[model samples]
Target: MSLSPAFLDELRARTSLSALIGKTTKLQKAGREFRGCCPFHNEKTPSFYVNDDKGFYHCFGCSAHGDAIRWMTDQRGLPFIDAVKELAQSAGLEMPATDPRAAKKAERQKGLHEAMEDAAAFFTEQLHGIAGADARAVLEKRGISAETARTFGFGFAPDARNRLRTALKSYGDAMLVEAGLLIQVEGKEPYDRFRGRLMIPIRDPRGRVIAFGGRIIGDGEPKYLNSPDTPLFDKGRTLYNLDRAAPASRKSARAIVVEGYMDVVALAQAGIGEAVAPLGTALTEAQLERLWRMVDVPIVCLDGDAAGQKAAMRAAHRALPMLAPGKSLAFVTLPDGQDPDDLVRSKGAAPMEKLLAETQPLVDRLWQAELAAEPLDTPEQRAGLKQRLADLIRPITDASVKYEYQAEFRRRFDAHFSPQRRPFVPFEKRTGGKRPAGRSGWQPALPVTEDAKKVHAAGIDRVLAKAVLAGLIRHPAEIARHMEVLGSLRLADGALGRLFEAVVDLAVEEQALDSTRLVTILARSGLGDVAGELLRADTMPYSFTQKSADPVRAQADLDEAIAILVARPEVDMMLADATSAMQSRFTDDAFERQVALVREKQALELRLANLVQANEDARALGPEEN
Candidate 1:
């Protein structure tokens, strides 16, 4: 039975050399490698060492050197096949099927690997040769030193498609195509897949060249291109620079995920060496779990833009469903419109370091994403937020971890949505219809004026919109404070939206406009009754007390109310669309969509109810206690 080289490599990688050696002899950590007395012979000097990085244990005392499998066979007196089987079981690897052609397959793979290595060397030579002047100039412009270029094995693939095929005639086109160095199509000759671009050799975890990535040096569509999935490479499972970054991670206790391979190279060039990138795909579960094997919390340094933010959210959402105790991702959003490559190039290493150091937890990022995705002023919207949080948390399979997350979410919800206390405790709830003592321990009571502003005749959305408009009118100068948010808002009431826009336009034109002046301007716009109704004390959904109604606080609260007012209509339309879509017979895709929409509607309704409840929390106390 011929064992495949990949299967053998898998077995070796999964085996802990130190553990295999330690069972028979004592071991001590000596830097990256472990040291122990030679188990092969009697010696106290300790000339034995197991190098996990190298995947072999060696003894100077006796010429004993082998990997976990060899040690099992040599020292434990097990047959070769039995040893491999035992180790495979221990490492949780399935045994490859026995095949008579396995030896030929393995030989072919070795040839392909050698061919790729030779191709990498040729490309590197081309980078240094006179033919690579343009590539070298681009390198110089990027500040990649000769030494750095050599370290990253930066190279150039010439524009001539047949250059590689001609030079590598020894390997022939068949193996080249198999190795992905040449592209093969029906009725077409094999040609180079990469040409006229900067070349990057992608290696596997064991530092073997399995694939290649190319970046266009000039105007091009993709900007960056990677090898397609082949027998030798799976883009989704491989990180661009893991072979170096894995060892580097041992020193830094962190791994940085960036957008492109060049970002990794740039960070490595800048002395921040612990960086890796997914091969032309969004961060996946396999990629994340691989990182977790290296560090407790990997830093996901994303580009600071809308697209980057969306990517971060996708990663966060994927991670939420797989979270375990002491395992998660930290997010570092680069400055707006900048990637690691851009940032490191402009600001050098310090700013990148600062951003990496000040990382945000995955949970906080998740909350921010959902919270900002929609308005939460209405009870339905707020409830929607809570429900989204729950859906995200429900994926935590670990009971203790799930419970702790639940508690944290509960605490946040309470902080944002807890019922406000009445100015004075209600007589029946506090004293069972009995009069309570005064503050000075005396039985004195004074008639209290109810906050008549708490009641509203209009719908909750309309009430909140009126309160926001009233706040803006009452403190016209404060309109500047929320102009950006107000301008962006799409109020559920069309008339209100138009009125709000006019108010903003006036605010910009007349900065010093006061409440009376603003109302006079609106009266001329034929929105005088709307303005009048909004300004009435009875339209206020929540009691913004004389103190709380200061320009700054009112502006903030008014913004929150406006968010709710705008969100309700958006939710209604979405719900209606979703309901209409569900009228069709349910398929797998439709079922998922229906479930998601129903869940969203539930949360929205809950949020609207919560906002209403919060407003109602302000009570009408008949008498004040002194």
Candidate 2:
């Protein structure tokens, strides 16, 4: 039972060597491949490696090497035919029948491959001939050297429609047409598909020319044209320069994805050989998988213009669902209006190298793209941003990775939209010992006296402070609503002040702040003693302090406490100033101001007393009534 090479190649491409070997080998991802102990021999250190991209397994210990079928035969002890049949069945491939027609078809494909090679040879000859002087000039203008041109198999397709057909007539017109070298119609005779253009050969993994991409020499509507899908090539699965870049990527431990073939060539010219490009389309899943096989994180270096950015985002979204642990993409945004090719030409490869070195991970790029998708000023727009982020994270198949992405996005959203306050500073330090200028010759109100400081310090109720802080911890969602009021008022107790600041900062940074996580983070930040004291059972009898407290009533009570706390400081400041003014002038207006301050202070005290009384009454009523 003989199988065609095409069938075997397709089988290898479809079958994942890692999944097959992992059944017994316990493989772990190591860079672009999976590594485990060699199953054929006793070894604890994991010398055996499997590469699904290349569809092969190798053992450094025993020097065992083969592909899917070989593994099935050697490891499973199956004969060649049985192994091939099993692999074919698993790969969803029908084993090729031993028939005359099947053999003829395989032979025909072989002829097609030969025909494409012949066409490439002819194009290369024409590029160096007098007829290709213009093409050579184009290459020179684009900084393509003669050696690089020859190495990449650069060639020219003359303007004449019959030039390629005439040169390769011995291979038969049908073969050339089937190979995508000539255009055939029902009524019209077959003619050259690529004419008056510069030709670059597109090859497979084994470095065999499977197709050609042609770029027009001068101004034209469709500047670039690629060969149509033939039996030998699938454009969506093919990447330009992959044949040459795979090994370079292995050595460099990275791969660079550019937008065009010329960019790959330019980077290669600049001595960076691990670069490839999609064949005239947005990156496909197959293409991305191929890139991941070469390196865990391939740097997608697209142009920095609007269209290019849009293309980069398209690649990112396409890759989201396919992301796995240790397998993802990184992106490099070239200088504005520039590409890898342009960057290399202008400033040498150093800038391009730097950009590649500092590539942004796919998640970061996705966040940035969605952040810039629309304005987040309105509530609806902000909700849309959150919804979009959720939508992006929904496609990720890995549970752990998806959870991490959700956390990261939530953190970013909170940081961006939540109100952030500067670190607290002393008034003297903030003012640099000089008061800010106000209206000319109108000095600001005098500072509070030492007596007033002592009065205000003694006025802060520790029980009230602990109750408020505990309530916030219990219902962390209410923290955002009270952030503005809480930010303005300073807690008088040192431990309480640090705890309050930590809670506010946590609310600003973490959108999904549960009581447990809030408390845990606070404890980690060296506030464990303060947190424990605040959360103690006897800390306060307020409904908000209890775990079973009604969120609505608790929030209301918390808001009331916050209002009283904020008002107290304002009243103290006003009363101190009014007292000073009365002592200095004793005018009717000043006396009235002092009277108003006294009344306001009395009202705030009454409110605080009533709040404590209401909580105690609720506590007496028990959890059901409260």
Candidate 3:
């Protein structure tokens, strides 16, 4: 769905940026803006700056800045729809449905959430009623305390089909089906999915009941009955105990991810308040992002079994690219055949706490595990291991973490593995045949792409967007000048342009607007990063003169910039190709026809290059030069 100016206007009018961001991270006044360490990226020094009066935040460290909607989407890992919904909720503003489809989705989500809540209440009542004795006995055997069960909202699903089905009949069969309370029979009635089991209500990080997990009391075919995939509940996306653990996770600057409902409950019960687990599913990016939102360091607490260790490794591998600087992961090994639940019950909270504190870094675990499995004594084995290590480390994009592992590998292998060895005769070594640089005779090149450069240049539209926005705020009359420039470009119709329009509308309303307020309003609209990039893009020289600290220095810088732009051979070549294609439009000479759209884009780039150069020269010569 497109982000419209009207939606942004509604969002800005309703919500306060400080209240929204302040709830997650501690913010303090720094000049006119509020400063806090970024919640998206780990940082010891504050880089997340929020201008309360302006209503915008920018993270200089990670380059993650956006309005409240954008912040909620990026920081809380919520989908765009959910992010808007959350902001609307915070503002006590009911977001109007843009379409019937959105309304239907919302209705389904609401019904499922409501059903889950009702089901939880039903199970809780049962736990205190007829099924209470059996469930409590099981908890006692598992060494779970009364307080622990209460804290986790533990319940019991009676062996009857009509128990919750009867209680929630008013919600209708569709709701029951969505909530996974009843399994459908072809051309017949629905039957209870979870019966004769202890019910565990699974909640999202916001403490909203979205689903249920039921563990059978005794011998059963399928051990657990999890809620079906519903609008509100996605097993892969939801983390068990996230709601209870997130506040603590933020406070501690760390979170522990376990594998089961019991593990999370046991950890929390045993005083490990920062522990959470994925709901009846493998770790997913959604869950990882959620964990990322809460804390800087997220520890993967795996059970000491083969399957569990494998799962932890998979999770770490998946998380590698998304792992920003300062964010860390550790692997904690419980005793063999023991999970958090078993360990906490057997050894108490202190041992579990110690294990968490003493968990090994994920990278260290990987290297240690790799070396232990491979016979690295022989030169061939060592060399193979080195390549394997490099291959494993290649996917790790985080420079700091990747380099740390590289340094560790160097330290471990330098003495023996550093020396070059050959399989052929010693005489062949004199021929100077060394292994080809990079992996498998094919290595991906760095230093950006032509497309990336195009995209970066396309980013100039963003600068103009910011200019249009800033101009509208400062001198509403100047907005027409900026828009005229923008109109000539036919900038891509998307979030950036929509935001520019929103700023213009606001400027029209305010008469004289503040840039920070515009930024804040833009931030609330959920395009903070795009707006920030636009605002932070290259400053034009005459514009600087208009806000003059010094026009002469600006002019000199502008001239140098233009010279640099003109010297780009690649850009010039691209521009020449574009202009030739444009000229071809008038001729019927069977020429090497340039692709129409690509040619126009290239021509635009050429025009931009010339414009930049001319602007630079004009700035260097002062206002009289124009």
lDDT of 2 by residue, 158-241 (tens): 999999999999988889999999999989999999999999999999899999999999999589999999999999999999
TM-score of each: 0.64, 0.64, 0.55
Per-residue CA lDDT of model 3 for 457-546, tens digit only, reads 553334434443443443344444344443433345787667766766665576555566777877887877776765454474223223
For candidate 1, the 10 contiguous residues with the lowest summed lDDT are 444-453
TM-score of 2: 0.64
> What does the lDDT come to for candidate 3?
0.67
Candidate 3 weakest lDDT stretch, 10 residues: 586-595
- lDDT: the better of candidates 1 and 3: 1
Backbone clashes (count) for model 2: 0
Give model 3's TM-score versus the native structure: 0.55
What C-alpha RMSD separates each model from the true structure? 23.5, 12.4, 21.4
lDDT of each: 0.76, 0.83, 0.67
- Best by lDDT, which number? 2
| lDDT (Cα, tens digit) per residue for candidate 1, span 247-323 | 79889888999988878989999998989998878998889888988887999987899988888888887887678
